[model samples]
Target: MSATLNPNIFRAYDIRGVAERDLTTESVVPIANSFAAMLVDAGSRDVALGRDVRASSPRIAEVFRQALSSAGLQVYDLGIVSTPMLYYGVSRFQRGGGVMITASHNPSPDNGLKLLINDVAISGDRIQEIYQGAQAGRKIVADGGAVHTTDILDTYVTELTEQACIGPRALKIAVDGGNGMSGPSITRLLDRLGIEHIDLYCDPDGDFPNHHPDPTQIDTLVDLQRTVLEHGCDLGLAFDGDGDRIGVVDEEGRVIHGDRLVIIYAREILKEVPGARIVGEVKCSDTLFSMIEKWGGDPIMSRVGHSFIKATLRENGALLAGEMSGHMFFKHRYYGFDDAVYAAMRLLEIASNVPEDAPFSTLLADVPDTVTTPEIRVDCPDISKFGVVDSVVSHFRALRPVEDIDGARIRFENGWGLVRASNTQPVLVLRFEATTDAELNAYQSEIMEVVTAAISACDDSV
Candidate 1:
């Protein structure tokens, strides 16, 4: 416990850090102890543990298992599975809690843990409690316990494939796992759907020798995009490091954002369950909401986190929810977790019913096109980023009302701009959208002016 721990590693949704630095074996003991104590308090004696194909994942997961076992918890080890598979193992095994050793879409050196208790994703203050307990080196009574290893992969894939409600239209898709854990299961799921897949970088390489596992980065998806165009594939599928988030490209080689992806899912879900509530995160296009309403479904706007969106979905009884970052949760036909492989299956099923003449992009031909900026991240210290957002919020509120749900979303007649602090990184995440390019630029400029001043003001105070 004497390892120098970086306080910033305790993120809003998970405990993330540069693996070799902040997440050293010595540093993980207290954090694991804190989680074990929390699980014990929640009456979760059986814990399922899984890891991504990161260089440090096995070591980190082993530490977690040992610590939880020391606390008299039964640890089920799901060896080298994707994040969604870990979630599946938790539900299938009926474990009271689960831990995933991964950093999601972060860089290679980064590694972290995603946690659950009582089948609920832990976030907000609960995460802070873990951090606090770890800071205090919280000690729990250690009654001896045992660890058991099992493989939930085969059962997990079978269940997902069995859930396919697809037509007989065979598909040709290019899948890029980016050397993460999604490669093995995606192939299985697609095969079960009877779709032809051109696989790329699906191998499990912790070093990420080919490219980073982040599909959102545009660069990481270059190979997939090229393959789709060259091979005349129907679509391109990409996954992040742990397979929870997804990245999609159309037959035209255009990136289909998560917001648009959810729109497609919503349209289909509403057909099955009319008036089903669907959640669109603040980052989604405004047209998504209108279309959901147009299609005889209830639309709810949400903040931008998997846990936040999941909570919103459960609270509102929403049939579906999605983020701009490629995290989609479905309560329509499967467990309400973000499983990229499952999402691909659903997308393929939707594609099956399409006419032969139509391209994948035609799925959203009904919605009007608009201009938007990709997520723009600005450097700001974790301690000061929230202060910057508060300053921006106050500055905007003085002139016109702002939507401060997750951050400051300043609305204009034609467009809106957002300024929010990243829960996982030391930065401020900003995005803007408008009916036209000129208006989009204007909104971005206006927001950046306030943001620049706010950042300076916050930095000065700090």
Candidate 2:
């Protein structure tokens, strides 16, 4: 067998940890071998291997390629591409699997692998299976296992631009790539579409020295916001580490969150595909679902996570889906995967219709203003986090009607709140929304009270 596998590294949707500590060359080898076996089981010997621009990524990717090759799989090396590009590379084949090496939004020292099997996102049991197989150290050699280095960036750009259905006018915008994987691809997209943009940290750097490559955290968008105001641009777009999540700033330098982004996309999409279903996670603003329904589209409320929302989209055949964490997925004339670069273009596509004289914030003028809290992450042990969530569910379920698809989404008379265990971390994520500050505070107080009690109880009892 291989070195004792770190169970913590095998997360829900990915394998993530501090690279040198948890994912040594010895560890990655068996993991890659296991993933190769997974591809083989899926009736495909071809595996797409891609990596981010992190300093440690190349070494990890090389280890993976070697292990995969040794395991008798044809490895398609799509070098130094974003996570979405890696997904796209795998999607090129009928039955394909791939691994993207990047700890999305995590710090520089952290690294991870997001896996897809037969182009379907792997999660839950599948990830655990990989971990189990890795422990087993299954390695089989077959003929014709080799590495095929490929270049699909131009083709990806060509296809994305070919499907362009934007307004006539082009506008100057600011783009903050966060020195991650979004630089080259977004620049190429902006160039092809004739969109003027001011670049902010558009070069890929593993250290992410400027700011953390997480667009969801408002702290990370300071540079992007400043750039937009200084440039007198119509808007700003920010991308996360692996270029799958997007953050936007309006002409007035207001941060437009993912929920607002979804509404904007939904409004435009409804014009073309009326009554198309859209999915958004519970952490999203209630306005997202209400507006989608009001705009003649079916809105499906999903649990918070990429894999869960993707499964919801497939189940409902939704044309679009989004998360509060800045992941926008569109099957409307494009692949249904979270791609910040594609979503940025789509945002521009919608904004292009707006008059040059008007500010971009006007697009959301109809979206009823509401008070919403950013995600509040409460520290809870992995063992007790879900239990605490369940206690919260029970407490709320006894008090009022609640939805617990992934957590307790309690809809109070004046507001709504969510309490759920994070899929990838040992924390209970909470968010609240209301029409007024008082209502928002009341909702938060009520939820936090129950959450605190439940967590205390979990700690003492179990």
Candidate 3:
């Protein structure tokens, strides 16, 4: 937080900004130092650090490592790794916490840091403390801490391979890593597991030559879908830049929604761990929650955001958790963290064991079909987004029953609508789902009217 640093880079979840404009070595030094100071203040010494495959990531990460070491914190450097690997390193190394230098699903030329403390994501006030401390030029007077280089690539691949419980069907799959951090690790894991697969953009090219490393986008997954069909692969999988969230396509080249993917996992998990807790974000489809209940598993809906989702998962001992944004976490037989690579492997395991007559999509055929919209983001300033959502909440709550857990999810007789503020960007996230197209349109239209009025009021007041 030097005088030139942009404080806006510190967001509700992680630290992020344009690489060229805001995140320079000068800015990274102070930010890293301040974060290390937090660790020192917490009586912690060892901190693991990793970076994605972005062009600017390595440079910023190097400076960050130097600053952390200079700030008297033991830095365990896991160079060029996915975000999940950084999380795993913290637990694998038994460190106080860790940091991942990534922009996640953002476009190239943007980068930032995701921090952890005590193996938990640091957000909200905890993130603010680091920014404030940096802005104030807080310092911890102590000798420089040690920096150690450790490679967990082989170990990570081996662990994932062993945990993969796929049957011996030798199913073919098409995988699109989108030239992000997932290539090497995923290829190695699949090879070891003896899964026949076709790889697309499976090299770590920061340029992202084929497509943006965002699986959630329709344009980005186009190649994955085509390749799956052309190659006669049973399914296709896509990963984001940092390799934590996932996107999937069935044999028919149809993109499976995130909520449906959760149902697939919950069905398998509930059979073993009956009455287990299953968590989903408020934006998730109601069908997902209902299916969980039908399977005898308790469903808990929480606010969206990885940090909040993980915290809720841990608190409830949930066997599985997911978001509409494609993040899936498993506490069933593995660590309770979101890893797209692992989720894909697990999906493959499930797909391979099914009978020849039943395909992967067939497993979810019983889910009540509903018309649902993908998350629609409305442009609203960061300063005013929350206020707009609050206004919407108030306007809708008096007229109908609403669940205000994270946002206002207004439940109608036949459908529901959600209005929430996006944590990372200046936008208001909205979604609508209903059993019928007419109901869906009515719900969407009514909610959008309220949202427009609320935003107008919020802007005038602000």
Candidate 4:
């Protein structure tokens, strides 16, 4: 184990870095050893491991599993599974914890891990604790634990089929897996659901030769939209590299952003669980909150991270929580983990009940929408991102009404804008949602002005 390993790999929510530069075998082995040692210290004897289609994922998982086994921890290998499947394995099989080898929506040259302790996400202080444990060389290595392989795909598919109440309807759909981990499970689930669909780039090709696995980027979804339109399919769906988040296109080949999807899902959830609590991140549309309220559900706002959303969900017993990035968590009748396949199935189920003419777009047609900017990322060094956010917060506090949920969210008369530091990247995230294009432009301009001033201050302070 080298003492020169970069501790920045252990980030706030997950372990992520460029594959060769930061996530090499040398660093990963020790990090896995450290992670296994943490589990052992917490009385965990068995763990589950899964990975996406990234080229680095297999080797990484193998090394990680070996590290866990070396620490006397049993490792159940779920070869080539989605992140949610890893979570499912941990919760369903009662494993001590789970590790998913994926960079999520990152570029192909990057890969990392999302770790769970006893089926719960380990973040915030716990992440620091893990890094500290690794730094201190505090690890337990015994001879009892072993590694084994399991095929849980059938079980995963069956559970999803039960959750999906898609009544019989002859509908054509197109799904683009982006050459990621969602293909296998998605194909299996759709088969069980008796759906007739076309699969584009369904193979688990780590090279991501088709496009980047991130469906949130409109460019990545171009093929999906084309397929849907050419085939005259009812809808088009795409999943990120790990299959935890999703992006969708309606029949008219229009992208339905995640916030609108949340609005659609909330309407359905409110029917079954009236007055139930729903959560949305600061990046989500204010229309979501108002719509949720109109549908008789209480809408709560939260920070823009999975750990934060999951914690808020558990605390409030929220039926659902959604992020603008297409991460949807449903606790209405399923686990709270973000599962894109499950979400797609739920969408299909909802679509089944609507009239043939009433497409998924109809749900959002009535919701008041403003010219919202897609999430904008500005490059800022990791060390300076938080300081920039702090300065922006201070500036906004003095300028106008602001909400300090996870960042500085400035409220305007007809809209709102947010400037927050990204938890997963060296960037500042900005979003503007307004009642009109003019207001949205104004909001975006005003907030960016504050952010620009703040960035200047950050540079001066540095």
Q: Indicate whether candidate 1 or candidate 3 has the larger TM-score.
A: 3
Give the candidate order by descending lDDT.
Answer: 1, 2, 3, 4
So what's the TM-score on candidate 2? 0.98
- What TM-score against the true fold does each predicted structure earn? 0.97, 0.98, 0.98, 0.97
In model 2, the runs with Cα more than 4 Å from the true position are none
lDDT by residue (tens digit), candidate 2, 147-222: 9998889988888898776787679999999999988999998999998989999999999999999988889988
Q: Give the clashing residue pairs of candidate 3, or none.
A: none
For each candidate, the alpha-carbon lDDT, in order, equals 0.89, 0.88, 0.88, 0.87
Count clashing residue pairs in model 1.
Answer: 0
Task: Summarize candidate 3's per-residue lDDT along 33-78 as a digit string, tens digits.
Answer: 7888898888888899999888899898888777778878888999
List the lowest-lDDT window of 10 residues for candidate 2. 87-96
Model 3 lDDT on a 0 to 1 scale: 0.88
Given candidate 2, what's the lDDT at residue 350? Answer: 82
Model 1 Cα lDDT, one tens digit per residue, 236-299: 9999889988999999789999999989999999888999999988878888988999999999
RMSD of 2: 1.2
